[model samples]
Structures are given as structure tokens and as C-alpha cells.
Target: MKKLSFLFIIFILIHSSVSAIDRRTEQFSTEFGYLTLPLPYVIPGAGMGLGFLGGFNNVPFGST
Candidate 1:
């Protein structure tokens, strides 16, 4: 069961790391970006939990 849970977590990380957006017309001149990743995991005793990992780049200095 522990091994299965670990594999599942690895799968989720691998799949989510891929970006599906097309950056053909997008310009990365400004330093404004945000990324929110889903945090899901299962423990032997703690069962399952869902959380999130997020961040903002140049949020204080970069203008919208």
C-alpha cells in the first residue's frame, strides 16, 4: 500500500509538470507570473489529504 501511494504521487507530479499552454504569441517581457499546483497525498496513518502549493513572481514590483 505504501509503495502504491508513492507511485501515485510520482505519477501526479510527472503529469502536472507538463505545460499545455501555447506560448507562440505570448511575450515574457514582464516578470509577472503565478503558479498554483495541487498537492495531494496519502499516508499510511493519516489517510489522504488535499492541499496546494502556489507562488507569485515579482508580485510586489511587477505591474499588472
Candidate 2:
């Protein structure tokens, strides 16, 4: 679990740096943004669980 967490953090850092570069090289647009939705629920016997739905809108470079 610890190793997984560490890797996830590293991945996020690298991805953020790449995204920053992409944003810098692109034309400024008001439609670019991200959304995150959290979902929490309970089950009859399985206890509780949480989930997230996230995405970026109008990504630069015509990429979805």
C-alpha cells in the first residue's frame, strides 16, 4: 500500500508538469477546466465505499 501511494504521488507530479507545459504553449481559452465529483454510499453488508468521478473539459490541443 505504501509503495502504491508513493507511485501514485509521483505519477501525479509528472502529469501535472506535463499539463502545465501544454497549457503554457496553447492559446488562452475560457473553456478549459476540470471537474471532480465525489460519491459515497453504504451497502447492506459490505459497509461503506467512496468513489470519484473526475474529468477535464475542453482540453487544449483539441484532445478530449
TM-score of each prediction: 0.44, 0.41
The digit string of per-residue lDDT tens for model 1 on 1-64 reads 9999999999999888885867786475455789999999999998999999998875665445
lDDT of 2 by residue, 1-64 (tens): 9999999999999998887444655485657799999989999999999999899976678655
Each candidate's lDDT (Cα)?
0.84, 0.84
Top candidate when judged by lDDT against the true structure: 2
Which sections of candidate 2 miss by over 4 Å? 1-30, 62-64
- Model 1 CA deviation exceeding 4 Å by range: 1-28, 61-64
For TM-score, the strongest prediction is 1
Model 2, CA-based lDDT: 0.84
